[model samples]
Target chain A: MTEVTLSNVVKRYGKQQAVHGIDLDIQDGEFLVLVGPSGCGKSTTLRMIAGLEDISDGEISIGNRVVNDLPPRERNISMVFQNYALYPHMTVRENLGFTLQIAKQPEAQITRAVNEAAGILGLDELMDRKPAELSGGQRQRVAMGRAIVRQPDVFLFDEPLSNLDAKLRTQMRVEIKKLHQRVGNTIIYVTHDQVEAMTLADRIVLMRDGHIVQVGTPLELFNTPVNTFAATFIGSPPMNLADGVVSDAGTIVLRDSLTIPVPKSARAHVKPGQKVQLGFRADNLMPVGHAVEEKGELVDLELTVALTEPLGTETLLFADLAGLEVQAKMLNPRPVQPGEKLAFHLMLDKTHVFDAASGVALRG
Target chain B: MRRRIPEWFVLLLPAFIVIAAVVLIPLIFSLYSSFTPYKLTRPSTLWRWIGTANYEKILTDVKFWSAFGRTILFLTIALNVELLLGLLIALMVNKVTWGQRTLRTILMFPMMFSPILVGFQFKFIFNDNIGLVNNALQSLGVSNAALPWLVDGNLAMFSIIFAEVWMSTSVFAILILAGLFAIPQDPLEAAKVDGCTPWQTFRHITLPFLMPFIFIAMTIRSLDVARAYDIVQIMTGGGPAGRTELLWTLMSRTGYVDARMGLANAMGYVSILLSIAFTVYFFKKLSAARAELGMGG
Candidate 1:
């Protein structure tokens, strides 16, 4: 087991910087995922840690040793590429045993390690087959097998499941989680899919445009995002943001005829007549007929339904709320049509208020 | 009911007629002439079938056998040296990120010249009295005597081989460079992570992937080199005492200069065996390499 630390690590491609200075501490045996949209420096950060890309400045240490100048082989790391970079000429057995052979291990030891990895990945029948003979899932498994046989200090996955279909990706996700539990190595996975980050990351590092926007547990980021980008990016269907100005009576004036009382928890973060953004998730805003916990202060709004999406047990209602398009959930199974008017309640405790100019969360 | 010919056959009739007139007729005529005692000056001798006489004569001719052996030796050395130099040039050119396109275009300059021109260029360069090589050696005090480049046995052979290699090595380079470009970057990175040194990665991954392309280049070059005439004729003329005599030069002398058409056709048929042998061998190797890379036959 090893702990990986990135201390102000930076990556610059000539005049264009891909990864700005970012610091992170991954505990021993931790499954840290670096995630963001494309060009967000998430993959670049993982590549630097893998020694595939050079760190322009600062230090990256694994097991308390600085590896800034180390080559990928000397860094004692194994990476799984998105395309499942198995040696097309080698059989599954040879692919697994390649690292040991490179290290000049004994034949018996190499064979044993190969067999063990094969057993772990359920590749016993495919030992004699080349990578082209295997299915996408099987090839991905062999890629992991190749990495695990090295038994390196760290495992780096650069969008390894992005090539698989949806069903296989989910299956491989669980298998990777199980592999981490079994092997207990320090793993860093990078992906643009927020769902994968939420499901698989022990601690997620959210990045945006060469900067680390936030780092926290999945639920923490879901419950308390640092800014509007994090708030919308972390959740599916995203959080609905509406422009508003706090009125003299501690109410937010969203439009000419619509005004809402400022959430009590955000009162200290804003002043009267201050411009702010009102944020709420689909789960927190629901139709009046739907059953909610009712623990927080609730406010009602009359919105016209623009669309409805029936998703099995519950339905998603797309409605125009206070001159802003918002998604609200309907717990009760009912048909919703366009132009239909409905009253929905906003759960104030679950909502967020942000500064209009900077997009920073207004937390008291 | 009346039977009718197919429309496709009618459409292909013109091509078949042209091929028969230009290719099939000459091929059959040569094969028939190889069994006769025909001379260019005596047209009546073409109908006299002297079966197996020319073949038997060629089988026992020591001079012809020596020329055949020399042609084989020339092809082997030229092909091998070209392959090695070509691989090196391809690797070096593949590494250049800037001006790579310009460098590739420049690399094809030698290939653009005709083999006859290349032979003449080398012929002057290797000339004993006023040649650039001898002049440079004498000026640099490296050699006092003029080297007999085209007269001596080994020197004549070396001069011809040098010209052949210089003119054709770029074929291998271009094809192998295409192979290098087709290699995926993922496996190289994976090899790096799997603890393979640069050399190990190249040996295990890069070379294996390039085998098919290499063999293809080898096959084409072998066929081209087997018909080695224009360069050898211009540079050495198979000369002083037939020291650099190859099959094509010897055959041309026998066929055209001496006007013994039937004997030359026999020699031609024999030399065609060499080309076929090399082609078959290289094709077998190509298919084997492709199969090893999991590309099905």
Candidate 2:
């Protein structure tokens, strides 16, 4: 396996700049994920890596070779597209052996390679069947099998599981992860789903509007988000932000007359009377008890319970707080009717402080 | 719920009636006439059921059989050549990124010109003395001898085939180009990643996908070739000792020029079998191709 490096890579579509200069170094055999919202240039970056698109500026090197001018075939990279682009005409065996046949490998070698791949993917029985005969999951397996048979230097997946249903997507995601472990090849997966990125990636590259925002492990990005975007993007029930002003005592005052203690690390960058934003994840806010009330600010919020979604042992509470909607996942299966007002306590030390103008997180 | 008649049937009634009157009636009438001594000049002869007399004559006549065999040969050669030329043209056009639309329209220029016009153009070009081809050859001193382009049997057939291919090959090109456009790009990309060479991708993925369209064009052109007229009529008129006599030309001479409508109806019936055979074969191939592509009906 060889590491991939992009040095100041840029992509342009006519007059429009789709991807701004992006520099990244992907380690050998690393499962690197590029995650972002739609139109964020994530797929474009992956396509450029696969050599499907030409880089408008800078260089891309694969396996220590400058692959800027190389076509996809010469790049030694195999791609699994979102739509599992199996040949409609060829059977599974033919599809798997297509590359070998094209390379003019002997017939015995082609059959052996195809059979081996099929066995690994549990596709041996379906080898004689064409793509139309296979179900979605089987087709996905075939697509993966098609890639695995190549044994290329790198595998590029452009949202390969996006077309499958939720149950199938989860199953295939696990299968893909297992495949990666078995093959030990460098993989660059691009997707908009944060959960997929968090679960599958060795290093997550978060992007917004064609620019890389942060690159780190899942937990690192979750706990140490550089800005409000990363902080809000990573969590399940995203981190909530409230407009607040720093009081003279160095605590931030919320709209509903609630005050949260700001950490000491934020005190130097932010001062009293300055506008700030209070950020906290859903898990940090809890129902207050008499004993734990001595630790931080105990400000109560009267929230209208808008909806209650129960998932086995936990219940998700969606409520309106100070005119902003917020969700909290409580572990107990508490019956919360819509329109019911509940008083909840906000944890002070667990909260984050952001500069109101720039959205940069004030760190401790 | 009460089952109401489909509104589509109401919308379809007019077309159905028009088709019945314009197409079905004529087709059935002609089929019936094939068994009778139908004469265009004398309408009364249409009802005279001569019952196999005309068929027997056509079956036994050496001239009729020769023309029949010659027509099949002409159709086979002309269609294959046209299909090959059309495929090559389409492949080239598919490669053209710039001015593709303009090139497509220009390629259709030959097809837009009537077969009769193409026949005349080629006829004059192949004329022995003052034609462009002969003049070019004579001026270049390639050959002092004047070639009889329209006299020799092989040359006559070649010239006619050339005219036929020139006039109709675009039919294949345009249809196959539409097929090429409809093919999904994913498989091609997948093939590239699969390390398939350009030729392998074309042979395995591209050609098989295009087979249905090729067969469809072939089927349509087969019938068109069997009933070949216009160009052959204008160019040679099945002359030079009947060297280039196709079924249509021979049948035309019998029915219209010589006014032997009874025997011509028999010849027409026999030629219909050729069209039926070709249409059936290509249609079967089309179905197989569709099945292969998993687009079953």
Candidate 3:
């Protein structure tokens, strides 16, 4: 088991810095995902760890060995690229056995490694086929199979599912997770799709603008994000944030003469006249009967439903609250029209308070 | 009254007539002449059909056979050597980041010169006493005596082959360079990540992608090399006991200098078999390479 550690690692392309000396320690056998929007240095960071790109500064150690100067081949790492970079001329068997062949292994050993990888990936039927003859998903599996045959110390996936269709992407994501469990190797997967990160990662590294915004369990990142970027980036329909200020009465004052008591977790961190933003998820602000949980402190609001999106089991109701459009979930079926009135319970304890100027979560 | 001709056929008639007058008629005339004792000066003898006499003479002729063998050797050596040098040059030029466009344009300088000009230029360069090569070697003190670059039996063949290779290696370089440019970067990157050394990557990944282009260059150069008349004639004149006498030089000497057009036409038709053979082989290789890359038609 190899644990990858990056300490003050930096990547610079000429005058511009892509990854700014970010430090992270990935535990052995942990499925760590680096996720961000485009140009966020997540791929650059993973490439540096994989030795595909050079690190401009600091050290990255794999299994307690400093691999700063090692080539990708010497580093003992296998990587799956975004475009599924399978050798187009070679058949599936050749592609899988290439590394072993390059290493000058015996013909029998090469065949065994190739066969085992093919079996693991359900690729026995495809051994004679070339990459161009396969579909996108099949090619992706071949790419994964090639990586598997090497049996490297670590596995790096750079947006591996980005090229697949939505259905195929979901299917491959599960296969990747299953492969990780089967191999039990340290895998560092990079993706901009938060759902993939949430489903696949044991712990997710949310990055923004060359900085690590937060590193936490999927649930931890979903439940308690460190900042506004993390809160919006990690969850679907993103946590609804409303502009507000802490008033003299120790309540949060919002636009259009509305006020709510501060969330208990951020109460001590708020000062009178402090400018802040209130954050709550769609599940936290549902209508009375459809609330996921009513254990938290609740404040009722009569809001006009601006839109309704029926998602079979649950419908997301968008309402105008203090001129900000807030999404609230409806667990029960509803034939709701736009501008209809509904009573939504705002869960105060489940809400977050961020300092408006800095966008940092105000924790007690 | 005659039925009105189709408009498309009417429109295409001029092209067909031009092709027949300029190409087909001459081809037919030459084929007919090859069966007769048609000397250039004796135009009346073109009608006298001496069936297979010229073909029989050349089939038994030792000089004709030697020239055919020499042409094949020239093509084999020149094509392979050009391919190797072109691949080397293209790979080096592909590596340069700055001024790459300028370097590519400079790389095409050999192709820009006319074949006749290239011949004369090499002819002067291979002049025994005052040639650039002999002068350079003498200046470097590598040789104390003047080397005969175009006179000795082996040296004459080398001079003509060197001149021909210099004139045409650029064709291979340009085509192979285009192949290099069109190749996907992902496979190269994948090879590296798959633990391939640079040489292994080149052998397994880069070379396979270039095979189709190499075969196409080979096909085009085969026909051009079979017609290797101008450079050989200028540099050595297939000379000094016919040491460098290729099929083109021998055919031209028989057809023009000896005025034996029928004999020369027979040799021409026979040499075309060589071109057709080379072309078919390269095309088969090209298709196989393309199919291997999953680009099969």
Q: Which prediction has more favorable DockQ, 1 or 2? A: 1
lDDT of each: 0.93, 0.87, 0.92
Candidate 3 segments whose C-alpha is farther than 4 A from its true place: none
Cα lDDT tens digits, model 1, B49-128, are: 99989999999999899999999999999999999999999999999999999999999999999888999999999999
Candidate 1 displacement at residue B192 in angstroms: 0.9
Over A303-345, each residue of candidate 3 has an lDDT whose tens digit, in order, gives 9999999999999999999999999888875789998999889
| Highest DockQ model number | 1
lDDT of 3 at A276: 93
Per-residue lDDT, model 2, residue B61, is: 92
Lowest summed-lDDT stretch of 10 residues in model 3 chain B?
Answer: B156-165
Clashing pairs in 1: none
Candidate 3 lDDT tens digits, B207-286: 99999999999999999998899888888889878999999999999999999999999999999999999999999999
What interface-residue Cα RMSD does candidate 3 give after superposition?
A: 0.9
- Segments in model 1 whose C-alpha atoms lie over 4 Å from true places: B1-5
Consecutive 10-residue window with the lowest summed lDDT within model 1 chain B: B288-297
